[model samples]
Target: MIIKTPTSHTFVTGSSEGYTPLNAFDGALLAAGIGNTNLVKMSSIVPPGTREVPITELVLPPGALVPVAYAAMESDIPGSMICAAVAAAWPTDPAKPGLIMEYHAHGHREDAESVVRRMAEEGMRKRGWEVKTLKSMAIDHRVEKIGAAFAAVVLWDL
Candidate 1:
């Protein structure tokens, strides 16, 4: 018997404001173009030789169980800021699995993205892998009443 693995991945980011924290999170997920599906949170590893795609190119059945590594932030204080980011670091050797890093905080998009990027780099370095490519996405939200920011690296089987 053979075991199949995810063949492709994508990065997505989104932000939204709502009357409640849960609603804000839902809005963020919708904005990220993944609101309807069930998300299966996975650990931080990109399969060896996985291809990268845009989120718009992903066509999964409605309510399908999707695997993802994600970061999310929510704020209820009016005018407070939140940011979320996710990064992927692929190794120079395509046969080696890569790393995924997620970060969320009360900050700006740049800060959040930078942090996750560094995290990805550090993770690859620790594993003695030279990074071949780095990809990241981030979102920032300013809370009116309740707001959320979300970022993810979604994976799927071919």
Candidate 2:
């Protein structure tokens, strides 16, 4: 089987409360505008020369398999906070692949985003690459009953 490398990436985030954990997850995905597609979890790597796209501009067909690096969390405790975040750090060298990081915890969206951004930077540093740009998205949900938070870096081909 031949795998085609993605040529672009986009960030998305959403949070919701529902009757069950799975329902909450589904609601969050719908809020994120990615409910219909199948999320195929992928390792954290952004190919060299990949472009950034706005979530509104990046379209996917219903039931399409989408590659994503993401973070998600679910909580059933009333009034408790749950957060998820994803970050991408592009290298200074155009030929070098970028790094992506995901983080999730019981916290604020800002905290989750901070951790993932730092994670991306550290990942790039570990690869001996200097970061030129960094982008991230995060979501936080307070559980009325069951709640979920989700964030993702979606990869797509041209």
The prediction achieving the highest TM-score against the true structure is 2
For all predicted structures, in order, the TM-scores are 0.95, 0.96
lDDT for each residue of candidate 2 in 1-158, tens digit (9 for 90 to 100): 21889999989998888889999999999999889999999999999988998889888999989998889999999999999999999889999898999999999999988899999989988999889999988989988999999999989987
TM-score of 1: 0.95
Error of 1 at 74 (Å): 0.6
Indicate the worst ten consecutive residues by lDDT in candidate 1. 1-10
Candidate 2 weakest ten by summed lDDT: 1-10
Tens digits of per-residue lDDT for model 1 on 60-133?
67898888899999998888889999999999998899899999999899999999999999999999989999
The predictions' CA RMSDs to the true structure, in order, are: 2.0, 1.1
Candidate 1 regions with alpha-carbon error over 4 angstroms: 1-4
Residue pairs clashing in model 1 are: none
